[model samples]
Target chain A: MELLKCETSDIENTEKYILKNGEKEIGYGYIKGVEINPIEIFIYENERSNGYGKLLFSKLLEIIKEKEAKLLTFDLPEEQYRMINIVAYSGGRYISIKNGVRRYILPIK
Target chain B: MNNTILKFLERHDFDLSLIKKKCDLGVKSSKDVNPIIAKYYIGKGEEQQRIYVADIVGYDYSYMNLDNSNIIDNMSYFYNENGDGYSTRSLSLLDIPTDEIVYRLMGSFTRDPMYLMEADKGKYVIDSNGLHRLHILKAHYLKELSELEEGDAIGHKILEDKYMVETMARKVDYLKTYSSFLFQQIARYYGCDFDIRPQYDDYGELTGKVTIELRGKNEKLVLNDKQFIKLLKDEIANFLNDNSISKKDKKHFIDFVGQTIEEYDSFKEYIKQNLQEIYNECFSDEVEVG
Candidate 1:
């Protein structure tokens, strides 16, 4: 699987990467900010339960580490149950819930 | 109906006639009836208490229980057992009490009603919608009550000043993107990094003071001139033509900013002299022709 970096213009310090398995785009993920990276990952419906989500997340972590960010954080809606497990698997800890949006933080060493 | 809920309705002086039983509404679904007066079942079987939602508008009448102490102080953004899932954007409106909502509430009745779910046996209610309107109303009531009770004109004046400060803070926040971009351009021209960090009070409210830092290329802090930068920002905001303020206030503001420009010019001269000294120390001998 190759994670191809995409050019971003509108938002500063935000990076997007598209995941490809033999030229077939399976999913994409992006991380924004430098000191604290607010990351997001997405896998197509047809690509579910095949570990592509984990792969995409791990690849994004590499980019975050390269940027020397202190931690990875994201606000997750309660309905996004599938991503919860993936975040939990990657040692992401629940921080707080505000207005039905749960914040999770994964410390980057 | 449970005895507790019945007494709650009585205490609040709700229009009990408008409340129809779930089945008595004569609708195929609960959605067909007016949601404000519709009966909802809280729990299952015997524990279930038939409940009615109340539409409390600040215009018509005020409920005693929904005053400063109960509804305003006890409003929670957290999720309760009732599962009223309000978005963060909707819930965040409770942060600042603005005059716009108050004017609307006093002018006419609006359909946007705050949905409060009875929690902990009707002690407090979790907030759902129309939080901003409810906050502004309750805060205004609280302010009036305080003025009456204490009879302190100075205290009332302080409240007025605080309100002005809060409004200015909000205006600054509204112009954050443009002001920050402008600051970035200035920073780039000066070969430094500019960052504006907002200051918050004990309650996490914006205090209208921001720390404007100028950092060197090595990320070391060079200057921390927040007051000067804040004045500059206000001057820039005024230049952008924010006519929401009164004409008298605008004239006073322009006069205030006119003095700041002289202060800024002197400040600029100081920086230029300092840079000239640094240039002499570093590159005086290195200059061969140019």
Candidate 2:
């Protein structure tokens, strides 16, 4: 698998990368919902739990750090099952969710 | 479910390799899970791990029982043995190793899909009604000591509790792809397929109820956040412009977001310094950004 991190100029609100296995596009995701790598990530369901999500998140962090981010944050939606557990278990605080979406912001300083 | 446990184990900083390595079991999940399972899988055979883990997991929900619960507990107020439900029968938690199911069960909360909701603090709703899922979920967990039987997919018996499956599907709103994803994930974990279709009686009479089958995973949803944001931004701008939200309300909304979000970012700081004033001066009546 290959990891490609786009530049900040290429960063949209929810920036992402194409996850490929050789010539095929297996999945696409990038860390978003925070200033740096805090919480948002996605790998196709068929490709989940295979260490891809974690690997992608880690790679995104490297790119962001190289771009001069001293800290990062994440705000995960509660219904995003895998991430909710991930953030909560990682000591992400539950600030609120009543405003429509739950928040678990992990500050990587 | 195994994946969730492995995730939980990793986050807790448990050493996954059990032998020669130190890994953050979740981030570095390649470690063999046998180390943790060994602590609970005290039995000798095929079902040993399954049954042993269930015992430990089942204990966490024990507090939901009246005998074990306090009078002030909200669970006590919601607990119902036989009442309005898909069925009073809850015979399995599938093969979910207990604790992980709790996390899965709580998935929709802390933010989740359409079927489950927190009606109030610590309360959950299905189809706008209360559901004591704890009783039902636990009622279905199988902790019996035995060997693996053929065709032994987990949640088979629970699926036999047709009312539960159908009821959940009935509440599902298909507009959100995540809802289907949730169904798929939950079912896949149980080694079952989940489906929703029109309900029919034994004689082929249309009951008008949505029927659900424990089967099949769907293709994953495409993530097009850039497109979604463009649409959402347009929608929000239109709403703000059409509604003529006053300068006061707009600033209040921005301030609310600022106060609520404690984490700081240079982007947010940039918005506050460069954009907030421009928005207040020019786009207060209409949200248009460059």
TM-score of 2: 0.28
For every candidate, give the share of true A-B contacts it also has: 0.00, 0.00
Model 1 TM-score relative to the real fold: 0.28
Error of 1 at B267 (Å): 60
Question: For candidate 1, lDDT tens digit of each residue in B1-290?
Answer: 33433433344443433322110211111112211111111111011121211212221112112233233333332212232333122333333233343444432222433333222222112122334444334444343333333566776564444332101000112123223433543344335565544433333333454445655433422222354445555544443355554545444433433343244343233324432332232234542211
What TM-score does each model's chain B reach against the true chain B? 0.21, 0.23
Instruction: Output the number of the lDDT-best candidate.
Output: 1
* lDDT, model 2, position A64: 60
Q: For candidate 2, write residues B124-179 as lDDT tens digits.
A: 22321123453324332321112224465664443323212211111111111222
Per-residue error at A58 for model 2, in Å?
Answer: 2.7
Judging by DockQ against the true structure, name the best candidate: 1
Model 2, span A20-87: residue lDDT tens = 78986656666555542443566776665445655666566666656655444444433454555444
Instruction: Assign candidate 2 its CAPRI class.
Output: incorrect
